[model samples]
Target: MQGRVIYQEHIDVLIAGGGVGGAAAAAALSQLGLRILIIEPGPAQGRRLAGELIHPPGIDGLCRLGLLSDRSMPGSPVKGFAIFPADKDDPASSVTLRYGEKPGTRHLGRAIEHRILKDHLLETVQRFPGVTAWIGARVTRIEENPDGSFTAMVRSNDGEEIRIRPRLFLGADGPMSRVRKLIGISHETRRYSGMMGIEVEDTHLPNNGYGNIFLNSAGVAYAYAIGGGRARVMFEVLKGADSKESIKTHLGLFPPLFRLDIERVLATSKPLAAANFCIVPNASVRGNAALVGDARGCCHPLTASGITAAVKDALILRDALSESNLDIATALRRYSRRCGRLELTRRTLAEELREAFLAQTPEALLLRECIFSYWRTSDKACVRSMALLSTVDTSIFSLATQYGTVALQAFRLLPRWFFEKTVVDWHRGVLRLVHKSLAFQYAAIRQWLY
Candidate 1:
C-alpha cells in the first residue's frame, strides 16, 4: 500500500530527530549554506524528562552557535557544584567546586527546564536560512544509493509521506535510535540505575548558584535551582528499589530547609521518572550516514555531561566537514576519529564516578574517601576535576593522571589498614588497588594510542 505524498524535496542533509543534537547540527551546518531538513517524531508540546543542566562547555557551544543567549533563554545560572558527603549532618562539611577556576572555561553553567530548552533550540534552528523542520514527522525508511547517498521516507503526524534525498544523513533520534538500527549499527545498552525528578518552588540550597549533590547509601541525589524561584531535585533509584519510597528515603538526606521544600512539592505533584542507562555503539559512521548525540552513545546522568557531549559532537562534525571540504566520506571518517576518544573518556569516567559515588563495595568506599580527601586538600584538584567534568579537557592523559593521583591518595591509607584490619585484609586491599590502577592505566594508554 502507498501513503499520501505531500511533497518531494532534495536537500544537502537529512537530520532525523529534531531535538538538542539535531537542532544544534542544523544551526551549525546552515552556516555552510546547505539545505537541511529536520524531521521530529514527537509533537512540539511533548514533555520528556531529559537533560536540563548543561555544563560550561555546552553553554559556550550554544552561545558560539548563536542559538542560546542569556537574555533569550530564561534559566538559572550554575556557578559550580556543591557535594555533601554521606552521613555528614553538618552543612560546613560540604565542598564547593566552582567553574572558571580552570583556564579556558566558562564562568557559569545553565539549568533550564528540559522542555523549554528543547523548544528554544528548535525555534532558533528553524529561524536559520535553508533550514526546515517538521515537528510531528519521522523518518520511517532509509535507502542507501550505490553512489553513496540516502533516500529517506518521512511520514507526518497526519500520515502524509514525503520522500527526501540528501547527500548526508545524520541520526540524532536519541538512545533507542531507529536511524542507527536502519543504518545497521549495533549498540550495547547497560542499565545503571533509575532517576526520579521533582520540581519545587522557593527551595533553599546549602550553596546558592551551584548544583547540590547529596551522597547516600542508596545512590546520589541532586538538587539545584532551575529558574525563577524554582528548583529541581533528582534521586537516583537503585535497581529493585521502590521509586517513591527511594525518593522519600533520600529527601531527609538533604538540608532541613531543602528537605521541607521537597516534601511540599511531593505532596503537591508527582515526580517524573526516567531510566539511567549507557549506550555504546559499535560504530558512529558508515558510508555517508552518521550518528550524533545519544544516538552515538550516552552515559549515566551522574556526570550531567550528556548535553555538553551532544553540543561538542555538533561542533566537531561541523569542523570535520569544513576540514574535509564537504566530502562526505572523508568528513565522516574525521568525525569518527575525533569523537572516538572523547566518547571513550566520557563513558569510562561516568562509570567510574558512579561506582565510586555509590560505593557498594569496600574498595569503592575507599576510593570515595580518597576522592573527597583529594578535593578537600587541594584547590588544584578541584579545578582539574571540574575541568574534566565540564568537558573542557578530554585528554585521556589528563584522565589517567587524575586517576593515578586519586589512587596514590588511596595508598596513604595503607598504614591505617595495617593497624585496623587483619594482615590478610590489608594485603587484599593493597593487591586490589594495584590491580585496578594497572588495569586503568593499561586501558587508558591503549585507548589513547589506538
Candidate 2:
C-alpha cells in the first residue's frame, strides 16, 4: 500500500473516522496550529444523525471547541429530564427532575439534529488553514514506526490512495472502528435489544424543553424536542416485539400521559427506524493510537450520553496532545487514564438503569419500583441521579452513591417484596430480587474501591 501511495504528506495529527469525535478533534487541535488530516467515509454533509441530544457537559465541550456560539446552531434548549417509571397498574405515574434544580450548576441541555451538528463541527475544522478534511475517505492500513509515529494509508472517494505520517494518530471512527482493530484493541459489546426511532414534524412534548423518558415493562420510550417544530422519539421494544407495527403500536407502549404527545408526533411523523441498543464496556487506548466516541465505547440509548461522551473525548484528546514535552505514549496514557475513568462511570450508570427498568424480570421490576420511588420521594436522590445522568458530574463517587442509596432502599423494601413473592414463587422471586440488587451493588463497589 505504501508503494501504491500516489501521494504522501506529513500531519501533526492524523485522525481516522471523521464523525462527531473526529471532526471535533480536528477543530480543537487546529487551534494549536497543528496540521491535522481527518479521513472520513461519510459525505461532506452528514446524512442521518442519531444521538441528537447533548447533555450539559457536551454543550460545555462544544463551547470550548468554539463550535457552540451564543447564537448557536439551530436547536432547542432542554431544561431537564422527565422520567415516567414503569407500573403495570398505573403507567401514568411520573416525576420530573429539573437540571437547574441542582446547586452550583445551570440546568440546561441542548437538542439538535445530529446531521446539523456534525456539519457545523466539520465546517469549523475546514475553516482552519492547518486542518485538512477528507470526506468519503477510508483508512486502509496503519503502521507504527519505531519513533512512535504512525503511517496511515487512506483511500479517497475517487479511488486515490494516499499515505500520511503523523506524530499522533487518533481514532474517532465510531463503534465499528477500523482504526481500533488495526491498532489491536479489542472491545466487548452487548446488544441488549432493538429500538425504534421516529422523527416527527410539528410535534411538541408535553414537557417542552426537556428530555422525556417513559419506562415500562415492555421497554423504554424517549422523547426530546429538536429545533424547528421537530422532535425525536426512541422506543426500546421488548423481545419478540414486531418491528413493522404501526407508529401507534410502538408509541402505545408508553404510558397514557405520553400517548397524546406520542400520537401527535406519530400523526405527523414518518415510519420509525429500528436500531439495536448496545454497549462496549472497554474502549480504552493502546500504544500511540486511541479510540473515541462509539469507537471508544457505546452505551444504551436509554442513557442518552453518547453525544456528550464523544465531545468530551475530543476535548480530552486535544488537550492531552497540546501539552508540552509530551511523547505520544505519555499523551495517549493521559487520555486513557482520564477518559477511561469517565467511561467506567458512564457504563456503570447505564447498566444500573437498564437492569432496573428494561430488564423486565419480576425482580428487576421490583428494583425499578424501589429506585423510582426513591427518586420521587427523595430530593437528594433526584438531584444526584440527574447530575450523574447529565454528565455534569462524571465521577464514580457520584454514581456509586446513587446506586448505593437505591440498594439500601431496596433492602428496606425486601420484606414487602418477600411477602409479595412468597405467594407466587415460594421465595424464589424474593431470592432473585435479592440477587439482582446485590449484583449491582457489588459491581459498583468494586469499581469504586479499585
Candidate 3:
C-alpha cells in the first residue's frame, strides 16, 4: 500500500513466522478488515518448543480468536498439570501439584505436548480464507522503508529469495531474530545464565497426563503429556551441571521414566537456553513494524508457559490493533506495554523460583523440605500452590505473598519438628522412617482411595 505493490493490490498486514503467535495475530488482524499474509519458515517441519502446558488464559485466547473451541479443533486438550521438586532425589518423593482446581476462571490449562499438535494449528491456518500461509519459506532479511512500510526478503526452501512489501510486517520468528537486530534494538539478558532445554519423548508415562515437574537439588526437568500416550521430558541443566552422565543419573531416579528407555529423544532435542538470556528492547513498532513472540524475548522454561506467553502477546497485539484504527505505532506500542507487564511478571517469578530451586543452602533446603512434605502428603498447600501458578492469582507478586501466608499458616498448624524431620533430614535416621510410613499411606490413598 505504501512502498511497493509486490505482495498485494493493497498490502495491509504481513506476519512473518507462522507459529502460534503469528497465526493468532493473523487471525485477529483479519477481524480488523485487513488482508493478512503469514510466512512460516517450514511446513510440518516448523521447529517449536514442543512441550506446551497451555494455561487457561492461553486457551481462553484461542477460543476468543476463533482458533479453537471445546475439543481443540486444531490441537488437543489436557485437563491440568503436576509439578515436582525437580531437584529431589526420589520419584515417590514428588509433589504432584495440579494447576487446575474445581469450577472457576482458574481451571487446569490444557497442554499441547508434542510437535504433531502443530498439525492441528496448521490445518486451521490452511482453511482460513482471509489469510495466506507460505510454508517452507525462510525469511532472511527485512527492510524498513523511510515512510514506515516493510520489505521482507524471504527465501523459499529451494533457495529462492522473494521480496514482498507489506504495510505492517511482524517478526514472530524464534529467539534468534534478524528483524529485531535490523531495527537496532538491544536486549537486556536476564536469568538464562547457563541452562539448556532438552525435549525428548517418553512412552511409558500416560499417567503423566499433565506436565510433571522434576527438580533435583541440582537442576529441574519438566514432562508434558503428548499424543500416543507419550510425554516430553525437558531437562534444564544448570550451571556446572552439563555432563551427559549427570543427565543419565537424573533419569535413572525415575523408575517409570526408565521403563521407556528412549535414548533417541534425548539425542535430538535442541538446547535453547544455551544462549544468554536477553530481551530485545524497543521491539515494538519502531515505525510501522511489530516483533511478536520469541522474536521479542523469552524467559526460562521452568514455568513451561513460554508458548502460551507468546500466544498471549499475539492476542493482546490483536486486541490493540483491532480496537483502534491502524495507526501502527500506537497499536504496536500497546502490544509492547501490555506484553511487557504481563510477561515480566511471569518471567520474574519463574527466575526467582528457579534460583530458589537451584540454591543449596539451609534456608533453601528448609523450603525444599516443606514443599516435599506436601508432595508426600498431597495436602491443601500443594493444591493452593498449583492454583496460584495457573490463573487463580493473576498477579505474580500476589501469588507469592499468598503462598507465603499459607506456608506460615501451615507451619503454625503442623508440628514444626515433624515437617523439619520429614523434609530436612529426609533420607536419614527417624526422619527417613517417618517419611517411609507417611509415604506408604500416601501411595495407597493416591492409588486406591483417591
Candidate 4:
C-alpha cells in the first residue's frame, strides 16, 4: 500500500472529520493563510438529529466564524426552556427559563436541523481559499515526526490511500475520536441507557418557542420547535434492545408526557434513536495534536450544550493560534489552560444537573421536585441556570452560587417533607440531609476550584 500511495506535504493544518468543529476551524485558520486539509468520512451534509439545538453562545461562535449574518439559517427562534415535573400535562407544575431575561446574553437559541447548520458551516469553509475539503474521506492513521509535525494516512473517496504531512493536526472527529486514541491521549467514555427522537410536524407545543423537557418516573422526554411547523421530540428508552421496538413498546409505558399526540407523532415520523453518553474531561491539546468538539469532552446530551461547546472550542483555538504566532506548542498550552477551566465547570454542571433530574432513587426524585419548585419561585435561578445551560457563562464559581441557592431551598423543604412522611427520628433525617448536601456541594466545587 505504501509503494502505491501518493504523498502530499506542506499542508499547514490537517483536520480529521469535517463536522461543525472541523469545518469551522478550517474556515477560521484558512483566513490566516494556512493551508487546511479536512477529511470527512460522511457525505457532504450530515443527516443525524443529534445536534439540533444551538444555544445562544453557539450562535455567537458561528457569527465569529462569519457563518451568521442578517439573514439567519432556516430555523425557529427559541426564547428559552420549559421544564415539567412528572406530569407533563399539568401546566401549573411547569417552570420556564427565558434567555432574554438574562443580563449580557443573547436573547434566543436557534433550533435548526443538524444537517442545515453543518452544511452551512461546510459551505462557509469552502468559500475560504486555503481550505481543501474532501468529503467521503477517512483518516486511517496519524504519525508524528521527530520535529513535531504529523504524517496522516487517508483513504480518499476513490479508495486511494494518500499521505499528508502537516505542521499541525486537529482532531474534530467527535466522541469516538480515532486521532485521540492514535495520539495516545487517554479518555473515559460511558453510554447511558438510550433515547429516541421523532420529527414532528404541524403541531405546536404549549411553550412553542421554548425547548420543552418533561420529567417523569419512566424517564425524561424533550421536544423543541425547529421551525416551519416542525419540531424534534426525544425521550428516554430502555437500553440494549431493538431501538424501534423499544420505542414502540415503551411509548405506552408512560402517561401522555407532552401536549402532542404521542402515538400519532411516532407513527407519522421516522424515529431516530441514540444512547445517552458522557465523556470524562481531558486536556484538549496533546503534543502537536489537539482535539475540538466531542473529541475533547462531552456532556450528557440532556444539557444540549455539546454543539455550543464544540463551536466554542474551535473559536478559542483559532484565537490562541492566531495570537501565538502559529506555534503549535504555545497555542495548545494557551488553549489547554482556557478550555480546562471551561471543561471543569461544564462537566460539574452536567453531572450534577443530570443527578438532580434523571436519577432513579426516591431521594433523588425528591431533590428533583424540590429543585423544580425552587426554580418556580426564584427568577434569578431560572436566568442563571439558563446561562449555564446555554454556555453563556462557564464559571464554576457562578455554578456554585446557583446550586448553593438550590441547596438552601432543598434544606428549607426537608422538614416539611419529613413531617408529611410521618418519619421517626425526623431531626436525625434533617441533619443527615444537611450533612449530605454540604458534602456533595463541597465535592463538586472542590474539583473545579483546585
Candidate 5:
C-alpha cells in the first residue's frame, strides 16, 4: 500500500487533526515563529456532535492565544450551571452555581455549536503567517528518522499523496487517534454510556444563560443555548437502554415549560448520538511525537470538561515548548508530566461525579444527598466544587479535601438510616463508604507525592 508522494515539504511542527485542539495548537505555536502544517481529514466545515461547551479556563486559553474574542466569538455566554435533582417535584429546588460568584474566577463560559467553533479556530489559525491547514487531508503513514524527526505520508481527499518531515509531531486527531496507535502508545477505553443530542430552535432555558442539568435514575440530561436562540438538549442513554425510549423518558424529565419545544424538535429532526467513554493512554509522548486533546486521554462527558481540557492542553504545550527554548524532547517531557497530573484529577472527578449522579447504590445515593446539601448550605462549598468542575483548580489535595468533607457530612446523616434498615445492612453501607473515602484519600496522597 505504498503510495507515490506527489509533494514533499518540511515544517517546524506537523499537527494532525484541525479541530479545536489542533487549530489552537497551531495558533499558539505560530507565535514562536515556527512553520506549522495542519492536516484535517474532515470537511472544512465539520458537523460533528462533539464538545461545544467551554469552561472559563478554556475561554481564557483561547483568548490568550488570540483565537477567540468578544467581537469574533460565535456562541452564547454561559453564566454557570443550574442542576435539577432527580425526581424533584419543584423546579425552585434546583441549585444554580454562577461563575464569578466565587472570588478570583472568570465571569462566564461559552457554548458555541461544535462545528462553528471548530471552523472559527481553523480559520483563525490559517490566517497566521506561518500556519497552513489542509482540509480533507489525513496522515496515512508515519516513519521516524534516525535523528528523531518524523516523516508522515498524507493523503488528500482527491488521492494526492504528500510527504512531510517535521521536527515535532502532534496528534490532536481525537480519542481514536491513528497517530497514537502508529506511535505505539496503547490506551484502555471504558464505555460509560451513550449520549443523544437534539437541537431545538426558538426555545429558552428556564435559567437563561446557564447550562441546565437534569438528573434522573435513567441518567443525566443537559440543556443549554448554543447561540442565536438555538438550544441543545442531550440525554444519557445507559447501556442496553433503548435509544428511543431513553429520549422520551429524558424529555419527560425536563420542565414542562420547554418540553413541548424539545418534543417538536425531536419529531422533526434526527438526533445526533455519540458514545460516552473514558480513555487512559499508557503515554502521551513518544520520541519526537506528542498527543494532545482527546488523543492524550478522555473522560466521561458527565463533567462537560472535554473542550475545556483540550484548550488547556494546547496552552500547556505552548508554555512547555516556550520554557524549554523550543527543545522538543525537554518540552514534551514537561508537557507530559504536567498534563499527566491534570488528567488524573480530571478523570477522577468525572468518575466520582458520574457515580454520585447516576449510581443507585446506597453509598452513592447518600453521597449525592450530601453533595446537594453541601452546595445548598455552604457558599464556599459551591465555590470549591465549581472551581474543580471548571478546571480552574486541578489540585489533588483540594479534591481530597472536598471529598473528605462530603463523606463526613454523609456520615453525619447515617443515624437517620440506622432506624430504617437492619443494623447489619446499615453498618455495611457505612463501612463501604468509609473504605471508598479512605481509598480515594490514599490515592490522592500518592499521586500528589509522586
Candidate 6:
C-alpha cells in the first residue's frame, strides 16, 4: 500500500498510545512547551477487563500526572493489597502473600478502569496549550525520516486517515506495538498461558489491604483487594477448554479451607468472567520509538504491576530527556540507558519467576510457598520484594541481591530442596539479566537502531 496521510498535522512529540505511559509523557512534555499529539485506539471489542492490581506508586503516578484528580472517587484511591498463596484449602497452605500496613506502603486497587485513567490523561493533554488528543485512531505505519524525525500513518474508525510528523515519536502503543515493529524493534513475546483471572466480590476479604495468591497444582490465583467490600479473584483455570465455562463448571471447586473467600466469590460471580492474557518482556525502546506498560514488557499479571511500571517509564524518560543534551536521539538513548540500567535485573527476576511458575511443578509450588512464608514473616523482606515490584530504584539489582542473599540464607534454614529450587530459577533469571545488561551496553556504545 502506498503510504499517504489524508490529513497532515505537526506535533513536537507524537505519542502513539495514551494509556498511562503515553498520557504521562504527553503531560510531562506539555509542561515543557512542546506541542504533543496523542493517538489512542479505544478498547477493542470484547476488551480485556484489567483485573490489574495497582500499587501506591501507581496511585501517586496518577495524581502526579493529573489523571485522577478526583479525590472523592472511591474507584480511584487504593490503599493496600491482600494476597493468598497456594491452596487456600490448606489451613497451613504456604505461598500466600499480602502487602498492606507496611511501613512505606499504602492503598491497593482503587477499583477503577484503565480506560477511565487513559481518558483522563487525554483530558489532561487537552489542558495543555498545544496538546491535541485523538481517540479511536490507530497508527498503522511509521516512516522514519533521515532528519531525526518520523511520520506516522494512522487510521480512525470512521475510515478517515491522517499523517503526523513529529520531531520525536513515543510508541506507548502497547504490547503489540506497530510502531516498535516498524522501527525494527522486536520483542521476545512470552505467552503467559495456562493462567486466567476472574473478578468476583461478595464480602470483605481476609484483608483488602494486601494482595493474595493461591498457588495450587492446578495453577496460581492472585487475589487483589479492590476496595469497598470487594476484591478481584484471579486464578488459573483448566488449560485448553473454554476457560469461562471451566470457571463456571469449577466455581464450586475452591477447597473447604478458603470457604469464606470462596463462598463470597461464588456469591458475587454474577458479572464475573475469565480474561486470558499474553506479555512482552524483551525490549523497552527502539531509536525514537519506545514502549511502556504492557507495551515494553508484561510479566505474570500475577505481579499486577502494570500501572506502576508504565507510569514509572514515563517519569524516568521525562527525567532522561530533561538531563540529556536535548538531542532527540541522545535523549532517547539516555532514556533507554536509564530503563535498562534501572530495570533489567529486576525485570529478569520477574521473568525467571514466570518460567518457574508456569509449569506448576512440585519445586515451583514449594518455592512459591516458601516465598510467601518469608515475605509475610519479615518486614525487610516484604519491603525488598515490594521494591522490586515497584521498580522505583535504579539499584534494584543491589536490593534484590541483598534480599536474595537473605532469602537464600533463610531458605537454607529449610530443607535443601527449596534452596536448590531457588538456584534453578536463578539460572534463567541471571541469564536474562546478563542478556539485558549486554543489550543496554551495546545500544549505548553503538547507537545501533536496526
RMSD of each: 2.2, 3.4, 9.3, 3.3, 2.2, 5.7
Give stretches of model 2 more than 4 Å off. Answer: 3-9, 44-49, 100-105, 146-149, 202-204, 238-240, 245-250, 253-274, 277-283, 411-450
Which stretch of 10 consecutive residues in model 4 shows the poorest summed lDDT?
251-260
Residues 1-450, candidate 5, lDDT per residue (tens digit)? 365643225488899999888988898899888899899987744357789888899998898889998777898998778998885576568888766554675679999999889888998889997999888899998887777656788898898877777788999999999999987889999998899898886364678788889988778899989989898889999999998888777877677768888887778888888898899999999988999899999998877888888888888888999999999999999999889878988999999989988988876778787788788877677778888888888887788788878777766666777666744645665676678778778878887687
**lDDT tens digits by residue: candidate 6, 1-450:** 354443224567888887777887887776566788888887556435563566666666766766565565444344433333434355344332333444654534455544454555676667777778777888888777685456788887676766767767888876677777887777676444454444445353444455655544355565555445555665566456566554543343344444455655556554334433455445666556666556676555655666777777777777777776456777777777666654554455565556445556554454454456566667666656655655544364454454344344334334554456665654444444445445545533442232
> What shift in Å separates residue 347 of candidate 3 from its native position after superposition?
0.5
Candidate 6 wrongly placed segments (more than 4 Å): 1-9, 43-47, 73-81, 87-89, 92-111, 194-198, 227-230, 238-283, 355-366, 393-396, 399-403, 406-450
Kindly report which residue pairs in candidate 4 clash with one another.
none
lDDT of 2 at 274: 45
lDDT of 2 by residue, 400-446 (tens): 55665665565666677677763344244456656654665675677
Computed on alpha carbons, the lDDT of every model, listed in order, comes to: 0.83, 0.73, 0.61, 0.75, 0.84, 0.59
Top-scoring candidate (lDDT): 5
- lDDT preference between candidates 4 and 6, better one: 4
TM-score each candidate: 0.94, 0.87, 0.76, 0.89, 0.94, 0.77
Q: After superposition, how far is residue 17 of candidate 4 from its true place, in Å?
A: 0.9
lDDT of 3 at 300: 68
Cand. 2 TM to true fold: 0.87
Q: How do the residues 325-395 of candidate 3 rate in per-residue lDDT, one tens digit apiece? A: 77777787787767766665565556656655767754445445554554455456666665545534445
Cα error, candidate 6, residue 89 (Å): 6.0
* lDDT, residue 304, model 4: 84
